[model samples]
Target chain A: MSKHTSMALRRPSRLSPDRLRVVVPILALLAMLVATGFLQPRVMSYFGFTLLLRYSLPLLFATMAQLCILVVGDIDLGIGPFVSLVNCIVASWLADQPWLCGIALVGAIFAYAAMGAFIQYRRLPSIVVTLGFSFIWLGAALLVRPTPGGTVPDWLIAATGFRTPLVPMPALLAIVVAFIAHHLIMRTAYGTVLRGIGSNAAAVERAGWSLLVGRALLYGAAGFCGVLAGLTLSGLNTTGDPWVGAQYTLLSIAGAIIGGAEFSGGIVSPIGAVFGAMIMLLSSSLLSFLNISTDWQLSLQGGLLTLVLALRTLSVWVGK
Target chain B: MKQIKFASASALALLMALGCHAAKADDASALKDTSKSGIALSNSYAGNTWRQQMLRVWQAAAQQAIDGHIIAKTKIVNADASAPQQASQIENLILEGWNSIVLDAASPTALNGSIEDACKQGITVVVFDSLATAPCAYKVAYDYVEAGRIPARFIVQQLHGKGNVLVVRGMPGTQVDVDEFQGAQEVFKENPGIKVVGTVNGQWTESVANKEVAGILPSLPKVDAVIGQGGDSVGTYQAFKAAGRPIPLITLGTRQEELALWEKLDKATPGGYATEASSSVPGVSSIAFWVAQQIVAGRKVPNVVKVSLLQISKADLATWLKVTPVGAVASPVYSKEWTIDLLKSIAANTAPPPSPGPTQNK
Candidate 1:
């Protein structure tokens, strides 16, 4: 810790870009919250925040899953369908057959790990491989629940609906998950080694870390987060749909990128990713609150995303 | 002057009695003041042509309601067909304190939790078109079975109950698709002479229907008639045209493109090319709007309200074609008065009034 502090102190300029990335998403989130509060002051209350952040829990978890893959220097195009697949399992089997649901979820993780190992071995592009897997996941989900009807387990609903007096459950869950993910991915020694693999796989391999195992573990972690996201979504919705999470693929990627995770890998902020997801979620609410025309809503959302990216770029240049 | 005054007084009494009789029949006395009520529409998607038309119809209805002081204000929020996003939007609408929320949902069951929450808060909730299955919320929906039955019966009649028919189905696994398919299948099964030789999932899109039909065209026997569940008739016609096959009696949706093609074929052919067009009208949003308004006004409403499918026959085809814009569906904007009568009929367990076709040109 002292060494890191001293190094950072010695070369503050080198770390400023990373610092700016974290700070910018936070600033954007705050700006959105403030704007929303201005438009609908009632949303400033505890209940209001609860409502605003309720559906974001799934997105936050999905973004973390994307972050796990992004940190491994591979994008998972199948995460959206994989999440939907997990949701179908949770909604269908978890209620009547807990053992079957458990087995299926574990099998999904193994499937993801196998895909990762295969990609590493064959030198195949992760994008193409995962895109292919996306169809498989979608087909499996459709087979499990052909339509959008399933009973979410009562225990799961009770867990997701768990509330507190001072803080909203969804907000609390996001913060807690962010902290744990941050500690696992940033604070530990293996975390450094994992990031090293992303930055220099050959060097890490030379240092005696099995690249296949590392990639598989990261993919497994991503699958785990996706399962959590799916389960939470099912609980919140009280139902399952094969196509419900189809939009999460791009949304998660955008959230991870806006949170300071680079496509080239070796950098990520768990806290920032959560805030980035929150910002994206809140912007839509803000637009709705401001009564923007429905025709302009989608394009305006795209414009906001571009504006944030540009701001991040500007900040990076300024930091330099 | 005395005799005239007495006569006028008796006439006023008679009119009052008639007014009471009508009010009792329609339960208009149950309506409470809703001048200060705010209503909102939480639409699941606005990407497709049908959804776009629905939104326009909703906005027109909402604006008139606001102008006439039926509602104080109205708002609309559209999500990108994501259930969670729509659920969140509903929560936001709840926060905005809308007295009533009319929604075209993304999923039937996915929005139940949020919808129930709204209902718990004493907010009147109306789910229409793509409806939610929340017990607490009212549902406005088309008789999809009837929609399917109409087209199948038309095809059966056209073919004299002896032909190989092709079925272009809508999005697989959807309730609408299932109901329509069941209705069509029931009709086809009863008539042993009509064999459904081929069936393809159209996903309710023109291009997909065309592609699927073209792919299956070579393998299937000659198709004498084609039955489609809306949005696929033009594509089916195109595929048949491309395959150099005789254009059979293809049942159409209310799309202007389909109507135009029908017109073209009618003019070109020796005998007039004839078929029927029917689908759930986009203007059902206006019906949903009034339902929400009436509910907010403390009117008793059924949990499920069945709307009539908009059907255009050969006689009404030219009239609908003339009024419907290119790329838009034929729909009649449902008025508040009509909705009230519909509720009365539903309550009375009588035949609901027929939909008045296309109020004005779009």
Candidate 2:
């Protein structure tokens, strides 16, 4: 515990690349929030923040899931479809048979872990395997709920609907989840092992750590986050759709990247990923508040994303 | 020539007088001053030709209403065909304090929560094309079941109830697909002579339909007729032609490509190629716009308003082909008068007014 505290507290220095990486996303997020607030002052209020942040919950979880995979030098092209499948199960089975839902969710986690083992053992490219699995996940989701109608359990709805008088429920949940993820991934010894494997697999193996176990554990964790995302999405939407979360795979990758996670692996910021997710989700709201024409909204959103990434690159250069 | 000119002048005068009288009647019944009311459109996706046409139609209609002092302002927000994105857009629309929202939803049930929130805020919500199941929101929708039944009926009659048929379906797991397939099955089940030898998911696109049909065509026996959801008829035709089989009687959609194909095929054959063309018009967005405006103006509108599908018979095919531009869906723009008449007919349980054909562009 002392060692973990020291490592967590060691990042107090100014002008560090790691610190700058996290700060850039936060600054981008704040900039977007200010721009939006300037345009629509109503959105500056408590109710306004609640409305703006409500839909970001699922995305935040998904981005964390992607961050887990990215931390281990693997990319999950299947996260979106996996989340969609979980959404189908949550909406269809959770209300009717909670036991079945539990079993199915656990079974999915194992499936993800097994996929990790298979890919590692066979020395297969993760991108190819995950891409193949995406189709399988989409097909399974369709089989579970062919159409876009399913009843989310009342308890689940109430759970997602939980509101606080002070901070909005979604914002509070986002911060809590971010801290938990940050603690687990940054302060835990096992997280170091995961990161070690990503940076130097042979060194980790030479250190008597099992690379297979680390990869499987991280993949399982990702699966768990994906399931959470799907459940929260179902609760919020109050229904299920097999195709609803299809856009999330790319969004999560972008969020993870924007949040200072690297494709080269061994680097991720849980809190930054949450902020990154918020930035991505709220930019559209900002555009909407600005009353941009519908034809130009999408292009402007892309431009904003590019701008944020450029800022991130500039921050890294400054830190250097 | 002088006599003809004088007669036309009197007819034009009578028409103008009648038009003025209709305007006077409409003005007297206007309850609320909607001149200060604002309406917004929350569209789910603007990716496809159909949705693009729908947005264009809405923009034109909304601008006209604004210029005519029917509404104070209008705005549009489009999402990326995702339920969560659209739900967020709807929430933002509510916060923006729009008096009315017209929606082309991404999903029927996924948007209910946001729709309910909008309704609770006292916003007039009108969902069209792809509708929401929320009780508070009004729906302006197509009779997709009837849309299915008509073409299937046409195919059954043409085949004399005895033929091997192929069913080219729309996107799987969609309500529209289910309804249309159900309606087609109802007719086919009633007639025992028609055998549905094969079925493929066309996904309501020409390229996908072509590939799916081509993949399934080799194993099946001779296909006498093909029944398709709109947008796939041309593809089904192309698939059959590529396979070196004689083109059978394939039902057509209202796509310009389909109509153009119909014209080409009709002229090529000794006897005219006969097939029916029918699909929901993208201009239904204008109807939804008008519905929202009328509701905001304090007019009583039904919770569910049905718009008729645009149907093209053999004789009208030439007219549709003439006016329909390449790569555009054949649709007649809906006017405010037409929408009011539609609402009145729905309330009175009578047939809605007939949709006019597209005016020939010089």
- Chain A alone, TM-score for each of the models? 0.94, 0.92
Question: Which digits, one per residue and each the tens of the lDDT, describe model 1 over residues A1-320?
Answer: 99997987787764487778788888888888898898899899987887888888889989999998888788889989998999999989998999999999999989988888898888788999999999999999999998888898788888888888799988888889889989999999898888877788899999999888888888889888999899999899888899988988988988888888877877888888998888778877887888876568668867877886787778778865
Q: What TM-score would each prediction reach against the true structure?
A: 0.87, 0.87
How does residue B234 of candidate 2 score in lDDT? Answer: 88
Residue A305's lDDT within candidate 2 is: 66
For residues B1-362, write the lDDT of model 2, one tens digit per residue. 99999999999999999999879867766657799999999999888888888888898989999999989899888888899989999989888889999999998888888888889889999999988899999999898999899999998999999999999999986789999999999999999999999999999899999999999999989898999998998889999999999899999889999999999999999988988899998888889999998899888988888887999888888888888889999998888888888887888899989897676422
In angstroms, the error of model 1 at B58 is: 1.2
Scored by lDDT, the top model is: 2
- In model 2, where do residues sit more than 4 Å from their true spots? A1-13, A119-125, A200-202, A293-302, B1-28, B152-168, B184-226, B236-249, B269-271, B360-362
Alpha carbon deviation, residue B300, candidate 2 (Å): 1.0
Global CA lDDT of candidate 2, please? Answer: 0.88
